[model samples]
Target: MSRLYGDPIEVWTREGEPIQFVWRDRLYAVRRIIDHWVVAREWWKVDDDDPGERRFWRVEASPGQRLGTYELRFDTTGAGWLLVRAWEC
Candidate 1:
C-alpha cells in the first residue's frame, strides 16, 4: 500500500493501552491499522552538573506531514521530527 503521514500524535487502544499515532490512511485489516507509531518513554540526561532533563517522542514513519515517520522530541538541541527512527513492525 502507499505510505501516509500526519502529526505524530498520541492515541489509546480500545483496551486503554497507550499507542502513538504517526500516520493516517484508508487502509485497515485485522489487528494493526495504517498508522505508524513509537513506543517511547522518558529518557533523562545530565552532564557536568548542568542539571537534568528528559526527552519526549513523536515518532513516525516519514519526516513531516507526508507518508512517513516523525519524531518530535525535546532535549539538549530542542525537538523536531525525523525521517525514520526505526522500521515499523
Candidate 2:
C-alpha cells in the first residue's frame, strides 16, 4: 500500500536527477529511479509564459537499511520539491 505525504523536502540533484534527499531530518540516498513522468493539469488554461508542469520521480531509496519506494515532485511553477508518496518495500 502507498501513503500520501505532501511534505516539503530538501533534495540534491546531480545532472538533473535526484541523488539524495533529506526528509524528516533523515537522509535517504536514491538507489535507483523506478520511474519518471511529467504532469501539466489544465494545460489549455495555463498561460504560454507560465511554467505549469510538475515533474515526478518514483525512486527506490534507503537510509542504510531496508529500501523503500518514494515519489517526489518538482513543480515548475516554483512550488519546489515535495515528497508526495511512499511505499515500503
Per-candidate local distance difference test? 0.34, 0.93
Name the TM-score of candidate 1: 0.24
Deviation in Å, model 2, residue 60 alpha carbon: 0.3
lDDT tens per residue, model 1, 1-89 = 32334243333334432233332432211232344334333346434544434343433333333443233333333333322233343
Which candidate tops TM-score? 2
Off by over 4 Å in 1: 1-49, 60-65, 77-89
lDDT of 2 by residue, 40-61 (tens): 9585668778848889999999
Off by over 4 Å in 2: none
RMSD of each: 9.5, 1.4
* CA lDDT, candidate 2, residue 5: 98
**Candidate 1 residue pairs that clash:** 60-69, 60-70, 61-68, 61-69, 62-68, 62-69
Worst 10 residues of 2 by lDDT: 42-51
Instruction: Show how many residue pairs clash in every candidate, following the order shown.
Output: 6, 0
